[model samples]
Every structure is written in structure tokens, then in C-alpha cells.
Target chain A: MLLSIKNLHASINGKEILKGIDLEVNYGEVHAIMGPNGTGKSTLAAVIAGRDLFEVTEGEVKYKDKDLLKVPVEERAREGIFLGFQYPVEIPGVSITNFLRTALNELRKYRGLDPMSAVEFLKLMEEKKKLVEIQSNLTNRSVNEGFSGGEKKKNEIFQMAMLDPVLAILDETDSGLDIDALRIVAKGVNHLRRKDNAFLIITHYQRLLEYIIPDYVHVLFEGKIVKSGGKELAIELEEKGYDWLKNT
Target chain B: MKEIKTDTKEIISKERMIGLFEKNREGLFMTDSEFMSRIRKDAMERFRELGFPTTKLEEWKNTDLKASLEKGYGYYLHPVIDVDVQKVFHCNIPHLDTAIIAQLNGWYVSKDVPLMELGNGMILGSLAEAFKEYPRIIEKYYGKYADFTSSGLTALNTAFAQDGIFIYVPDNVSSQKTIQMVNVIHHPESIFLQSRNLIILGKNSRISLVHCDDSYNQQASFANIVTEVFIGENASLDHYKLQNMNNDSTLISSVYFNLEQAANLESHFISFNGGLLRNNTRILFNGKGGTANVRGLYLMDRKQHIDNHVFVDHANPECTSSELFKGILDENASGVFNGHVLVRRNAQKTNAYQGNKNILLTDTARVNSKPFLEIYADDVKCSHGSATGQLDSEAMFYLRQRGISEENARMLLMYAFANEVISKISIEPLRLRIEDMVKKRLRGELSVCEHCVLHCNTPERPLEFDIDVTKI
Candidate 1:
């Protein structure tokens, strides 16, 4: 198992969000978590990413059989956990290339490995740029500064492609993206899918599933996975909505 | 109100000055021309009257110089120890192509043994030599802008100052490489020294100068500096002052700019470390169609204090001026920014703007920012704004969520805030060097060179924070 969560209850400022979330994921699988508005979809992603904003009151998380709850955020990232932010931050004066290079070197140092050479890093960046179809100017510009909404989302997926995390969480990556941009983002995610990697995409709509197929679909309503099924479940929920799942 | 006390120490200082004047009276060169003698005399009398500014005065209310003034610092006419330029300061900025002029203990110490003259008809040498050679030009703009009566520090510098930097750019000539006037104070004892600089830009000419003040030891010292810049019509000048000294040093520097018709001036003040740093900057629009931009950035920690006072006189119509100053105070450091923009009655269509922003990192860190606009002209457009706040917690959390360590995240955001001021640097290499220095500073990695006295990284006790890894 790549990730295992048992009765995970999280809250924010004395208000509970994820009452009890128990989920398990295996390698080489794509899980689409479909939910309604304010159904703890983003909170689940933040919990998995070890975001300090949410307090985990009970239960535990295990990543690759280690106690993931005790890991720091940056250490989690170095351990191959990536979170694609819903609203990417604009870090002025830090170019995208510099940020990525620094992150990569830090991770490499943590793993007791030699850092990537400048030429090799540039080549990898070139390949990832083409894979994500981002403008060349973005590599030179500040990270997400003055970027359009679509460009910001595209930059997130581009970073995912560069980092190549083992467990990647896409928290509303489909939001605020046009159809063309959606296709580009899905295609970038699909190109990076491998047997050793898994994805848990948290999104509200089923429009994104048309491009990238998921093996399993989970209906997350009121902080719990009320229903779990195959890919067609997303289509079924897209038509019937979460009301049917909650009532059932 | 407490009266301005003429202490016994000040009297001794004045008597020492009179004694020094009598000692150098033969070589005083008073007979060279009456123009130079009158300036020295007027400045001497003023210094006799107003010894030093007092806290009772409204201008010196925030910063009390009593701690620095009562030290009874010894006066030094020259370096008490052997002054070897190479051994004292071995700072050669990597890849920086500057014709460096060195000054030790307020005396010009050059490498060429005389003066440096480029093919572009520019002169860079000792001010004492310039006074003997170009006395006419020196007399025309020497004591033109600085008011000797109000600022006793300026009067002291004008009266007792002997040697400093002097650069003269001929008409229609531009300096190829930026001239770096580096003043290094490495005295054996706690000393007091005054230095003066005179810069002249001819019509349609240009010059970029990087003026630096550095100290070697941890002993206390006082540096009183006065620089006068005369910009001819259509000429442009880029001036940058880099000040980094030991925490036991006190520096009082006054810079005056006189802008002619269609002339432009850009001045940047970057103060990295100091004990008590005070800068009085003044810009006068002597003719129409001129513009001046003055900006400053100061990073201070510990018990450091910085005071910057700027005044831009829009005495001519159709002139534009702006001032932007930003400072980051950590620990118990305090700062004050007083900016005044004056537009006279006949100065119509004068556009002026002033801004001062500060970030106090700790609870005891404080800043006093006041932006004043005194406009007598009816048709002038002028505005001023001042803001002081802490770093944005949201911005910090946002960066940390990207998997960057907390320390690195804070450093990145701080660098971003500081880059807003450094981004205006037109010179790429210089900007890059400054950016690198700032990064090292933010990371607490930069340290003083064993041989160089320009900058040192004092090892501070590790800062402790009660940060909850489980909660931001």
C-alpha cells in the first residue's frame, strides 16, 4: 500500500472538517475523489500534505509503512509527496527556475545523493517545459507572479512533472481552468503516470474525468467516503449528484 | 526645555581645532584665494557657535547623541599606525570593474601616488589636490548647498576636514566605469575624523559613483562626512552610498545635490550594519526641467539606530522629485525617517512624491516615519505616505506550504520585499553583487574577511521561536 489513513479526524479552529476519513491507496492507481462544495475535499488534500493549518485530532496516516503524521512538511515533500496548490502563491523575486533548482537540490541532499549538474537540470527543465506546454518566459519570470489563472494552474502541473512525486495530490487543479487548459493539465498528469506512482485528485466536477481516466472513484460527502466504486461511479454521481449518495 | 549645553568637552574640542589650525597655519593656503579662506572662516565661526545638535531641538528629538557625544573621542590628524592600503582593505569586489579610490583616516590614499585621470577628460583624486588645482570650480559649488548654521556636524566637517575624494567630469564626457570612492577607517584608538567630498558633473556629462564607508575594529569612532554634488544642465548622476561599520561606530553623513536645468539625479543609500547612523540628504532644483530621485534601504539588528532626513527643494518650476525609503529593523533596533518636500511660490507644475515603509520584526523594534510636504505653489502636485508593519503571516505560510523550510521561506519573502528597492539599480553586476550580499545577510552567512574591514558577519545567538510544526 502506498498510503493508508485510518479514522482520520481533522479540524480547524474548534470546527471539525474531516470527521472520519478512512482510505487506502495502492501503487499504479488513479483515484478521483468527487464531492460537493464544502464537503472536506480540499481539507483531505491538506491533511495528506501535512499542512499545519488543519489539526489532526485522532487516527494516523502511514506512507510507505512509515508514520507520515510525524513528518515535517518539507520532509514529506522530500519523501515524494507533492501537493498541487489550488491557489499557487506568487513569490516575487524568486524565479521559477531558481525555485525548482533549489528544491531539487535540497531534496537530493536529503537523500544523500549528488546534486544535479546545471546542464542536466536545464535539460530536464526543457523537457518538462515541453511536457507541460508552458511558455519559455515563465521559467525566467518570478514564480507565479503576474501569471494568468490558467498559467498558474499549468505552472503547478509543470512543477509536478519536474518533481515526479510518488504520491501526488491534485487539490482542485481543474478549478478556474478553461477546457483547453484543462486538457493540457490532464495530459501533463497522464504523461507522468507510472506503475510506481499514484494520484488522488480532489475535484468537484466530473468534467476533468473525460480527459484522464481514473481506476477508482470515491464519493466524499460530509468528511466521509460514503460510496466507493469504479470509474462509472463518477459519471453516475455527476448526473445524480451527492444528494443521492447522502440519502442512500 | 533643556538648554543646549556647551559642555567642557566641546570646549576642549574647539580649542584643539584652534590649535590644529595654528599648527597647519603656514600650509593652510589661505593666500591662494580669498574665496576658499572665507568659506573656512565662516564654517569655523559657525562651528564655534553651534557645537552639536541637542535633543531639545525638534529635529534631534528622537535620536539623542549624548551617548556618542560624551565619549570624548580623540581627534586624529592622521593615521596613528602605519597605513598600508593593501593590508588594511583587501576588498576587491569579484568581477567589479571600478577605478577604486581609497581613503584612510579621512586622508586620500591613492594607488597611483598622484591622481587617476581617464581618457574621457575625467579627474578622480584627493580633494586637497583639487582645491589647489581647480580652486575656481571648487569655490563655485563647495559650500553652495549645505547650510552651515543649522547642522553643526556639517559645520564641523567643513571647518576641520582636510582630504577626501574629488571627481570632476568635463563637459559632454561620461565616465566609462563607475568610480568607487571607498573610505576605510582603521584607527588604533577611539578617534573622531571628518571627511569632505566634492563631485562636479559638466553639461551633458554622466558619472556613476559608489561611495563606501567602512571601519576595521570594534572600538568606538565617529565619522562626520559632507559631500556636495553639482550637476550641470542636461547632465545625469547616479550615486550609491554603501555603509557597513562595527556596532560601536557612529556615522553622521550629509549629502547635498544641486540640480541644473534638465539635469537628473538618482541617489541610493544602502546601510547594512551600524551603531547609530544618521544621514541628512538635501536636493535643490536650481533650474527648471530637473528631476531627482532619492531612495534608501537599511537593515539593522541589535540595538542599532538609523535616522534619515531628506529635503527636496522645488525652487524651480517644472521640476519633479521623489523619495522612497524602506527599512527592516530586527531585535531592539529603532529607526526614524523624516522626509520634507518644499515647493516655492513660483514653482508651478512641480510634481513630488515621498514614501517611507518599514518592517519591525520584533516587539521592541520600532520606527518613526514622518513625511512632510510644504508647498507654497498653488498648481503643484505633491503627496506623501508612510507605512510601518510586520511581515505578512499569510505570505509566510504560503511559501512554507510549497515545501520550503520555514527559515528559507522567511528569507525568500524578506528578499522579495528588499528587492523592490534594489530592482531600481540600473547596473546589473552591481545589483547582482548586492543581491548576493543581501541573501547572505538574510541567511546570517556572510562574515567579515580576515584581512578586509569592509564587512563582517557577526555571529549572533541562534534566534529561538516557539513555532508549532503542527499549526502555522
Candidate 2:
């Protein structure tokens, strides 16, 4: 198993958000988590990403063989964990290239490997930019600064490509993306998927899932997984809506 | 005379002493020497008559100097035998065509400046040398622009100034490079040092002046400096002053800029260190079509106190002025910013904008900002604003959610805030140096990751971030 969560409970500002979330993902498997607003989907992703704003009241998150909670957020990323934010921050004066270089070096440090040379890093960046279909102009600008909605989302996917992780958490990455961008991003992700990697895709619609084609579908209702099934479950959930999970 | 009880005795005495000036018999008459002796004596008499200003005085209320006076700082005359002037004086930019003046302990040392090549009726030399060579010009502009009524510090500087730089750019003669004046303070003993600078930019001529002060191996040294700038009609001047003194030093500098018709002025003041610093910049738009852009940046830590007071007077019509000052305060540091824009009745169509912003890194740090606009004119566009806050919480959370540590996230946000002001700096080399200094300061305060240092230290290098959502 790539990731195992047992009875995860979390809260924000003393109010419980994630009551009890139990899930599992295997290598090479893409699990799509679909839910309506305020169903604690984002909160679960945030907690798993180790955001300090939300406190995990009770639960255990096991990644591989170690307890992921023991590591810091940056360390988690260095340890092969990635989270594509729904709204990426704009760090002015810090160019996109500079931010990624720092992140990549940090990951390399955790793995006890030497950092990529400037020549090699640029070569790798060029190759990955083609995968995500991001323009060269955006890479030279400040991180997420002055970027359009689609460009920002595409930039998130671009970053994931730079820092390849064992477990990738796409938190509402499909939001605000056009059909062309969606297809390009989906293709980029599909190309990067391997037998050693796994994905936990979080979205509000099944349109993204139809393109990415997850192996399993899970319904998150009020923070806990209410139901789980194979790929056909996503089509059923799209047709029936979230009312069935709400009543359950 | 009634004495006000205060926590600091030094402050109270400075305030009460200004009143002593009024009792002197010589109101505006000369009393001390030949060159500026009379003017200095008259100014001293005025200063003594007025004593030190109190909080009741509108301008001096925010900045109290009573403590500085009460400390009884001795005058730093000539340098001691143990001092190495060369080690104490260093110029970061040396290739400029303009002359360079180096002063040590309130005295003019040997100058290797290339003033003779500036043959277009330009006179760049030591103030004392100018007094002997061109006494007429020295007497004409010296002590003419300093205001004794409003500024006791200016009066004190004029009265006690020993040696300084004197620059005169003749009409229609544009300087090829920037002139530099380096002030080196090496007095270890508690001493008062007064330095004066006079810059006269001729009509239709352009020049750049850069002044930097270095306090090396100095303890308890007090520097009181006054720089008077006179820009003639249609002339342009770019002035830069950088103050990076020792933490134990105290500095009180007043810069007076007088602009003529169609003249343009760009001035930048950067203060990075000082125990207690008070800077007063007063610009007089005396000519029509005159424009001034004033910018400042200050970083304070420990118990340092930095006060910046700016006054732009639109005395003539159709003049424009813009002022922006940003400060970062950490530890128990305190900052005071007061920007006043005054547009007279006849100065119509005067465009003025003033902004002051500060960031407090610690709860103990305090910032007092007051931006004011007094427009007596009918047709003028004037606006002033002041804001004090900390790092944006939303921005901080956003960085953390992306797996950056809280410390690195804060540093990034602060760099952004400081970059807003630094980005406006036009000089490329100086801007890069300032950026590096800012990064070092941030690293000293925060636990920056090694990877971050590797990425940020690679000057001018760019990085790339690719996001492929399908994989993750």
C-alpha cells in the first residue's frame, strides 16, 4: 500500500471538519475523491499536507512504513509527498524558476543526493515544460504572479512534474481549467504515472475523472468516506449526484 | 524656566536648552570667525534663545532630542594616532567620474578626488579649501538656506561643523559620473561630530551625488550632519545617501533641497543601522516646473529608534513631488515617520503624493506614522497615507500549504514587502547589493534551509516549477 489512513479526525478553529476518514491507495492506482462543498474534502487534503491551520484531533496517516505526521511539511514533500493547491500563492520577487529550484534541492537533500547542476536543471525543466504545455514566458515571471487561472493551475501541474512524489494529492486541480488545458494536464499526469507511484485526486466534478480514469471512486460525506467502488462508481456518482451519500 | 520630569534626563535637557538662545544679545549678528563665523554665531544665538524644542512644538513633538544633548557629547576634532583612516574609509563604487571626498572624525583628510577634470566651471573640494580658494561662493551659499527657527539640529550642525564637502556644478555642465562623499567616524570616545555639505547644481546641468557614512570601531559617537542642495533652473540632480553606522552610534542629519525653475531632483536615503537616528529632509520647490522624487528605506532591530521627517513645500506653481518611505522593525525597535506636504496659495496645480508603510516583526516593535497634506491652493492634487501592519497571514498560509516551512514562508513574504521599495531603486549594482544585504539580514533572523540558500544565493539565476496534475 502507498498510503493508509485509519479513522482520521481533524478540526479548524475548534470546529471538527474531518470526523473519521479511512482510505487506502495502492501503487499505480489513481483514486478519485468526489464531494460537494463543505464536505471536508479540502480539509482532509490540507491535514494530510501538514497545514498548521488545521489540527488533527485523532488519527494515523501512514505513508509507506513510517508515520507521516512526524515529518514537517517541507520534509514531507522531500519525502515524496505532493499536494497541488486549488489556489497557488503568488510570491512576488521570487520567480517561478527560483521557487522550484529551492524545492527540488530540498527534495534532493532529503534523499542524500547532490543537487542538479544549472545546465542539467535547465535541461530537465525544458523537458518537463513540454509535458505540462506551459509557456516559457510564465516560467520567467514571479511565482503565480500575474498568471491567469488556467496558467496557475497548469503551473501547479508543472511543479508536480519537477518534484516527482510517491503519493500525489491533486486538491481541486481541475477547477478553473479549460478543456484544452484539462486535456494537456491530464496527459502530462498520465505520462508521469508509474507502477511505483499513486494518486489521490480530489475534485468537485467527474469530468476530470473521465479523462484521468481513476481505478477506484470514493464518496466523502461530512469528512468520512461513505462509499467506495471501482471506476464505474464515478459515472454512477455523476448521474445520481451526492444526495445519496448525504442521506447515508 | 520650568523643567519637565521625564524617564530619560537627556531628552528633557535638550528640550530645555533651546530656550537659552533667546536671551543672547546678538540676535542675527555674526560672533565667531571670518568665513562662516558670524553666521554660525548668529545661528548659535538663535538656537540658544530658542533652546531645544518641546513636544508643544508641532515639528519636534514626535522626535525628542533632549537626551542626545544631555549626554554632553564631546566634539570629535582631529583623528587620533591609533586610527587607520584607510581601513575606516571604503567606497563600493569607485569608477565614477565625479570627485570623491573622505572625511575622518570631523576633519578633512587627504583627498585623491579627480576634481580638476571637471573643467566646466565646476568646483569640487573640501569646504575648508573652498573657503580659501573661492571665499566668495562659500560666503554666498553657506548658512543661507538653513532654517534656525524650525530646526535646532540644523542650527547646532551649522554652529559646530568643522569640515565637509563643497560641490559646485556650473551652468550647462553635466557630470559624466556620480560624485561620492564618504564620512568615516572612528572616535571611540563619546564625541560630537558635525559635518556640512553644500551642493550647487548649475542651470541646465545634470549631476549625481552619493554620500555614505561608515562608523567603524566607534563607540558612543554622535554625528550631526547638514547637507544643503541648490539646484538651478532646468538642471537635474540625483542624490543618494546611505547610512550604515555602528549600532552604538547616534546620527542626526538634516538635508535641505532648494529647487529652481524646471529643475528635477531624485533623492534616495537608506538607513540600515544606528542606535538612535533622526533624519529631517526639507525640499523647497522654489521654481516652476520643479519636480522631486524622495524615497527611503530603513531596517531597525534591537532597541534602535529611527525617525524620518520629510517636508515638501510647494512655494511655486506647477511643481510636483512624490515621497515614499518603507521601514522594517524587529525586536524592540521603534520607528517614526512623519511626511508633510504643504502647497501654498500661489502654488496651483501642484501635484504631491506621500506614502509611509512599516512592517513590525515583533509585538514589542512599534511604528508611529503620520502622513499629512496641507493644501492652501485651489487647484492641486495632493494625497497622503500611512499604514502599519505585519506579514499577510493569508500569504503565509498559502506558502505553508505548499510544503514550505513557516520560517521560510515568513522570509519570502518579508522579501516581497521590502522588494516593493527596493525594486524602485534605479541603480543596478546598488540594488543588487541591497538585495544581498536584505537576504543576509533575513538569514540571520530565521533558520533558512540549506536548499533555500543555494537557490537564493545564485544571483541572477532563474528556476522552473512544472505542474503535471495527472501524476499527482
Candidate 3:
């Protein structure tokens, strides 16, 4: 397994957010986690990204046979784990180019390599920007400042393409995006998909799964996954609301 | 009588100033006309009555100068001359194009070459020379703008001030080059010095001045300086002040701006490093359709303390004034920002705004901000706001999620906060230089920045933030 979480438990502010979450993933696979609101879907991704907000009281997150919870947030990124934030922050004075360069250099430094040249970085940014079809010039602008909802989500996908993480967890990346933006984001993700990498897409509805084409889907309800199935389950859930699963 | 309070703590500087004045009475009054002497005498007597402000006063409530005043300083009757001025006080701003004037130990250092004489009757020289050559002009605008009765420091500076920078622009003339005043305090011991500057912009004239206060030595010293600027009808003045001094220094600077009809002024104060700095900025819109924008940014750490007190008086209709001040405090450092805007009864259609924002990096760091708007006119739009808080946690989390370390993320946010005011600088080169300086300050790189002309030290703790403010 490329990543594994066994009997995971996490809480914030004395309130348990995730309880007894068990999941496994391998390379060359796209796993979709579909859940209703307040089901701890975002919390799971945040914990995996090493956010200090939650305390993992009873859990073990194993990545590449190492204790992933012991690593810091930035180190997790260096170790090939990326979390696409649902709401990107607006940094007023930090340009997009500067933020990305600093992040990229730190990851390179962790891998014991020289920092990328400015030319290389800009070229890489341009290439990745093509995947998301971002028309406006974002390099000179402050990060996420005054960006439309669609543009912010697209920028996230663009960043994922640039970082090329082995295990990418995009937490609710499809929310607040229009149909065209949704297609553009999914296209960007599909372009970056490879046999050596994996993606965990967290979404609320089946609209995005049509484009991303997840091989497996899991239903997370009230901080626990109640059911697991293949792509056919999504269509069934689309027809029958989540209340139908409560009877079983 | 206002029942002035006098104690031993504040009387030391006053006594020293009066003693120095008595000793140098002849030399001080050497080139003075009767009107000038009478102005000086009135200021001297006012200083005797007003004395130094105490904590009881509303303006000095947050900042207490008891410790600074108790320090024993050697008073100076004259600035130490005979040293090589050019070699010691060389202008080091890289690629900055400006008309430079150097002041050594509170006295304007006369350049060997002739002073700048722009055609159209614009003259830039020493105030001492102006007293002899242009007495009528000096007597007209010298003490006209500065309020010496309320501030003892201003009164003291006016009384003992013998030589400083003198700038005059005739009507319908505009200076092509920005004038830079480099005031270098290079005394050997703990000395108390007072200096005054006079700047006059005639009708339809324009000029920009970059005034910098730099100290060359680490010895303890005190500086009480006053500057009066008069902007005639339809004139414009862009003033920039940069204060960089050692850890054991005290600087009290007061600037009075008098603007006439349709006059425009943009003033920026950037205090990068200092021990104890108090800036008293007063602006008066003397006529209609005038606009004044005053902005300040201070980056203080360790034991440094900076206070910015701004007062804008809209005495005429259709006048606009705004004040924006930002500060980043680390370690045990503290700062204060007090902005007051007053719109008189006849000053209808006045637009006034005042804001102060601060970021406290450490638990021990402190900041006090007060914004006040007093309007006697019902047809005016006046607003005031102040904010003091820790860094935004959501922003921090977002940055860290992208793999930026906790340290660098905080630095970026601080620079961003201060940049809001810095971005308003219209001059490109000055804006860039200030941007670089602000970055160096945020990174605590001033101690290690070899290319930086300003020299300073950094503490060991390096202003680390409490990054675990995640509420959820």
C-alpha cells in the first residue's frame, strides 16, 4: 500500500471530528470519498497534511512504511503528500511566483538538490498553467488576492500539477466551482495523472466524479465510512438520496 | 496659568537648554534682526512655562519619558566642527538621485562648493545663512506654523536652534531634483542637541524633501528637533523621513505643515531602527481644496519604543486629510499611534480618515492605538479606526499547508501589512528602497544584511511566533 490509515481517531476543541477511519490506497489509483456536510471529510485531509489543529488520539498513518504523523506539515509536502485547500488564502504582498518558488526550493532542499533557476521555474509554471487553462497572468499578482472562486480552485489544480505529489488529497476542490471551472479543474488533474501517483478526491456530489472517474468510492457519514463500492454506487446514490442508506 | 507641573525628572533637560542659551546668547543673537530675537525670546519664555509633558497629559498618557529624561546628557553650545564632513557623512543611498545636504551634530555642514541655486529664484542653503541674507523671509515663516506654546520640546528647539537646513522655492517654480537632508549625529559623548529647519514653498511651486536622521556612534544622546513647512497657494510638498539610529539614543522630532488653497502634500515616515523615537506631526489646511496624506510605518524590536502622534486640522472647506500608520512589534518592544482629525465649523465638505494597525509577534510585545475625529460641521465625512491583534491564523495555516515554514510565513504577512502604506509611495526608487528595507527588517536580516547601509544588531530569540493558534 502506498498509504494506510488504521483505526484513525482525531478531535478538535474537545469534540471528536473523525472516529475509527480505516482506509488504504495504492499507486495508479484514484479513490473518491463522498460524504455529506459535517462528516469530517475535510478533517481527514487536514490531519493527513499534518495540521496542528486536531489531536490524533488513537490512530496510525503509515506512508511508505514510515510513521507519517511524526512529520511536520512542510515535511509532509516534501515527502510527496499535498492537500488542496478548500478555501485558498489571500496573501496580499506575496506574489504567486515568489510563493511557489519558495515552496519549490524548500522541497528541493529537502531532497538534497540545488534550487531551481528562475527560468526553469517560470517555464514550469507556464507549462502547468496550460493544464488548467488559466488565461490571466497570476505570476505577478499577490497569491489568491481578489481571485474569483473559479480562478482560486483552478489555481489549486495548477499548483498540484506543479508539485506533482505522489499522494494528493484534494479536499473539496470542486466546491464553489461552476460547470466550466469544474471541467477545467478535472482536466488539469487528469492531465497530471500517472501510474506512479494516486489521488484522493473529496467531494459532496456525484457531478465531479463523472469527469475525474474514480475507480473506488467510499461513503463517509457522521465521521465514519459506512459503505464502500465501485463507480456504479455513485449513480445509485444520485438516484436514491443518502436517507436510503440509513435503513441498511 | 494652566497650573504647569514641574518635577526634578523633567527639569534637567530644561535647565541644560536654558544654561546653554545663556552661555551662547551673543553668538546665538549674532546675525538676528529684532523680530527674530523677539521670536526667540518668546519661545524661550514659553518653554520655561510649558516644561516637558508628563504622563498626566492626555497626549503623553501611553508614553512615559521619565526614564529618558532622567538620563544625564552633556549639553552642547555648538555642533562639533573641524572634522571632515564629506568623508564622515557620505550619502550612501545606492542609485538614489537627489540634491544632498549634510548636517553634522545638529548643525548644517556648509559644503565647500556653492549651495544649489535653481534658476527662477529657488535657493537651498543653511538657515544660519538665511538669517543674515533673507531675514524677512525667515521672519515671515520661521515660527508661523509651529505651535511652540503647547510643546516644550518644540519651544526649546525653537529657542536654541541656530543652524539647520533652509529651503525656499519662488513662485511658479518647481524643483527638478528631490532635496535630501542627511542629519548625522556624531557626538562623542551623551549629548543633547536641538535644531530647527524652515522650508517655504511659494504659490504654484512644488518640491520634495527626503530627511534622514542617522547616528554614527553608539553613545547615548538626545535630539530635540523642530521643522516648519509652509505651502503657499496651489503648492505641493512630498516629504519623506527615515530614522535609523543606535540603541542608546532619544529622538524628539516635530514637523508642522501649513497648506494654503489647493495645496497638496504627501508625507511618509519610516522608522526602521531607533531607541526612543517620538514624532509630533501637525498639519493645517489653511485654505480650501487642500489635501494632505500622512502615512507612517515603524518596525521595532528589542527595547525600542516609537510613538507617532498626528494632528490634522481642516480649517477650510473642501479639504481632505488622511492618516495611515502601521507597526510590527517584536520582543519587549512597544509602540503608540495617536491620530486626531478636527474639522472646524466652516470647514464643510471635509473628508478625513485615520487608521492604525499593528501586529504583535510576541506575548511581551505591546502596542497602543487611538484614533479620534472631532467634527464641528455637520456636512463633513470623518472616520477613525484602530486595530491591534495577532497574525491571522487562517492565513498562517494556508501558507504552511503549501510548505512554507512558520518563520517565513510570519515575515511575509508582516511585510504585507506594512506594504499597504509603503505601496502608496509615488516615487519609484524610494518605494523600492523602502520595500527592501522593510523586508530586511521582517527577516531580522538587518544584522546580517551586508548590502544594507543602515547598521544594527538583532536579538537571539529572533521574534518567533506562537504558530499553534489553530482554534479548530
Cα lDDT of all candidates, in order? 0.82, 0.76, 0.82
Worst 10 residues of 3 chain A by lDDT: A131-140
Tens-digit lDDT track for model 2 on B1-472?
A: 2221112223224443343333332432223247576776777776666655566778767666656555655433333323333333333342334355666665565535423325577887677667666778777787777686667667767665646888898889988766767776654356567788888888899987777775655366677889898999999998877776767677888889999999999888777777788888999998899999999888888888899999999999999999999888999999999899999999999999999989899999999999999989999998888889988776676565455677877877777777877787665555665677666666653111111111223333221212121111
Candidate 1 pairs with clashing backbones:
B447-B457, B448-B456, B448-B457
Give the CA lDDT, 0 to 100, for residue B60 in model 3. Answer: 90
Query: What lDDT is reached at residue B30 by model 2?
Result: 28
Tell how far residue B97 is off in model 3, in angstroms: 1.7
Tell me how each candidate scores on DockQ against the true complex. 0.33, 0.36, 0.69
Q: Distance from true position, residue B379, model 2, in Å?
A: 4.1
Instruction: State which candidate, 1 or 2, has the greater DockQ.
Output: 2
Sort all candidates by TM-score, best to worst.
3, 1, 2
Better by lDDT, candidate 2 or 1: 1
Residue-level lDDT for B11 in candidate 1:
22
Candidates sorted on lDDT, descending: 3, 1, 2
**Number of the predicted model whose lDDT against the real structure is largest:** 3
